[model samples]
Target: MRKRVAVIGGGIAGLAAAVRLRDLTPPDTEIIVYEQSGALGGKLRTGELGGVTVERGAESFLMTGADGAESAAVALVKRLGLGDAIRHPARVPAALAFGGRLAPMPGGTLVGVPGDLAQLGDVAHADAERDHDAGRPLLAEGEDVAVGALVRERYGDEVVDRLVDPMLGGVYAGRADGLSLQVTMPQLARTARVEHTLRDAVRAAQRAGRRVPGKPIFGAVEGGMSRLVGAAAAASSARISLGLPVREIARTAHGWRLLLGPVPAPQTDDVDAVVLAVPASPAARLLSGVAPAAAAALGALDYASVALVGLALPPGTPLPDLSGFLVPPSEGTLVKAATFVTTKWSLPGDGPVIVRASLGRAGEQERLQFDDAVLLERAMSDLGALLGGELPPPVASWVQRWGGGLPQYAPGHLDRLAAARAALPPGLALAGAAFDGIGIPVCIASGERAAEDVSKAWEG
Candidate 1:
């Protein structure tokens, strides 16, 4: 009999896993991907704006490679015949809203951690004094610490709120104080344990030749992220069932049994292997019967909700020449960050200038409760300050809300992941932003790794 493999989610991670499974397993192996939503590409969604397709979720992904090597994501895109469709961002620096005015981000900073204390100037807190005693070791031996608390102790509160909060918010949609330093920025965390100060550690790394010159760091699909989703689905050849959420799972004599669809009238599938590529909460709920310990750990994880508002302004509106600006949490604004969509990517057709505004963070979901029109108004208010004046009534507008979008990596996240993975069954694997890194490429890699894990078990 042909082997059957089941993928619980149809997001990038699940799709990538299904594709990898197809390649690793025999030709007759049957692979199926079940997605609860009507559409694929969980966060890689795109929408029409100004007659052009623009990304509603993640716009671009950071590339990873050593010098001349191609990143996994780049290789995948090229393999899918999308090599020519890759577009790099226009050269522009992002500005920081500080002291009631826009200021250029300080040079020699890594995710808001300043490499040189002298560079901070007015950005550092006025009463902030560098803690020379950071070398005394506040964290327990071999323990993780919050990124914001560590920075605040070494640098100051202003540095954490002004520089670190905005940069971390742009990535996790969570506050820096709640995020793990080791998980978010691994290299810095390692150096912090040995070096007396962040500045010293950064200097040491620079001396050790850690800089890469003239290398592009980010890439996006020419049309939209939706193209990547379509290509992955085609490449995998896995049966995709949309709007069919898997409700339950049970151990079977052959391998496993999945109960899918609504509770009243459900569908069942028996599979030799299963890959869970869904969010932490859903995965936890599904695993309760089989892996209670893993389920409990997953249930402990927290998520941050965010909203993206896309606006098309009249042509020739005087906007900042830069890519976009980030609002410091101290600014007391609903909008956290704004991206100049047209400036950052090549849209399908030019109808009007497109701008994407991001609102809400982990603890700031109160503003997201408002209606779309009200949210648009709040976004416009922030954009007005960014552009130094009120923007013209948007020719087109869209609001895409992602509830529990980003998983918060609180301190000890790595340890928790290890425990959860140890508790999972032999042929059952988990993947997604909840376990590994949160970037697009990382999520893809996580799914591929999960597929590889299940393949080994099946072979044994």
Candidate 2:
């Protein structure tokens, strides 16, 4: 029988899997990709602004390679012929924006939760007025309730509310209180529960010779994340039908048959293997019959809504010197985080600056109350106050709303994933930010790992 593989969804995860399957399988093997949307980039989309570039979803990938993310990004760039269309540095600076000022993230701080309990306490120190008590140690308050609980337990309520919540707003876009610190922040959560103090864990980790990343910042191609996905799509051998949405999946004698949608004609494509690369909810619906247990788990993983409001302001504006600011969940607003785009990128020329404020994190709490117009008004007003002055209105504005934007990693997320994988059919596989990781590199690594496992299974 001819070996054929069907990859569902056309986003980066699916795209990466298809590309990997093409390389691993023999020349006679067949691979076909199905996407619900007309586009193949998934969460990655880009647009133009007076010849300048703007992104609606992801902006960059954290580069940790000695040669830089160049190699990882090379696949897509070469595939899409966009090698020269963009430039991404090896590193970018990260800062906390508060009181209209940017402060370098404390040194030796990893995700604002140090491995050492003492360091963790220092990092959690709140603004003088907020703390009220000078030199008061900020230990998390919660006792094994959830991620929010754990952070509050070790770092204190102030730290959890102000810094951790805001920074995580960008990562999870969900209420920190509900997040399972274990699932969302494995290292810190583990340290808090298992180890006596973060410092003890660090010493143990050092003895074991484990190291973590330094800076927690990421940036992308000048054009946008689409540049990377477009390149990946080009490199794959699969026949990509953009706009061709998959309606159903039926188990077959050899493998499976993917039913096409939007205008179902009962058309089905048979394949020896399949890879579903879409988000959790969509995949769950498609696989309700194929893998009930896995589907149920997928459905259980809650995904929250998100919106990005990109502002293009006039030049010569007296804006506050800031790289970005994270709004704590305590703010009780729709906005979880905001980044000073033009300042962060240091894009040449000052012709109107660019600032992107996040309006909805896991569905706007306060920020979401108002429509785009109201949100924009309040955001600009805040910006003006923070930037030091109320500047002219924006030359252009783009409000990018994601219905199911980011996945919430409740506690037990890792264990649940392991169970889902074990429950999946031996020939079936899962790969994407939804399960194991959420970053670009993590997704790439996930695709590669899934491919290796799938290849091994087929060989075995």
Model 1 weakest lDDT span, ten residues long: 126-135
The TM-score measured for candidate 1 stands at 0.95
Off by over 4 Å in 1: 65-69, 126-129, 133-141, 204-211, 346-350
lDDT of 2 at 430: 85
* Candidate 1 backbone collisions, by pair: none
Q: Model 1: number of clashes?
A: 0
All candidates' TM-scores? 0.95, 0.84
Task: Write the residue-wise lDDT of candidate 2 on 274-357 in tens digits.
Answer: 787878887788779888888888788877777788888777655555667665565454555677677777776556677787
Residue 41 displacement in candidate 1 (angstroms): 0.5
The true-structure Cα RMSD of candidate 1 reads 2.1
What are the clash counts of all predictions, listed in order?
0, 27
CA RMSD of all predictions:
2.1, 5.3
How do the residues 238-341 of candidate 1 rate in per-residue lDDT, one tens digit apiece?
Answer: 99999999999899987999999998899999999999999999999999999999998888889999999999988776677778888788998888898887
Error of model 1, residue 259, in angstroms: 0.5
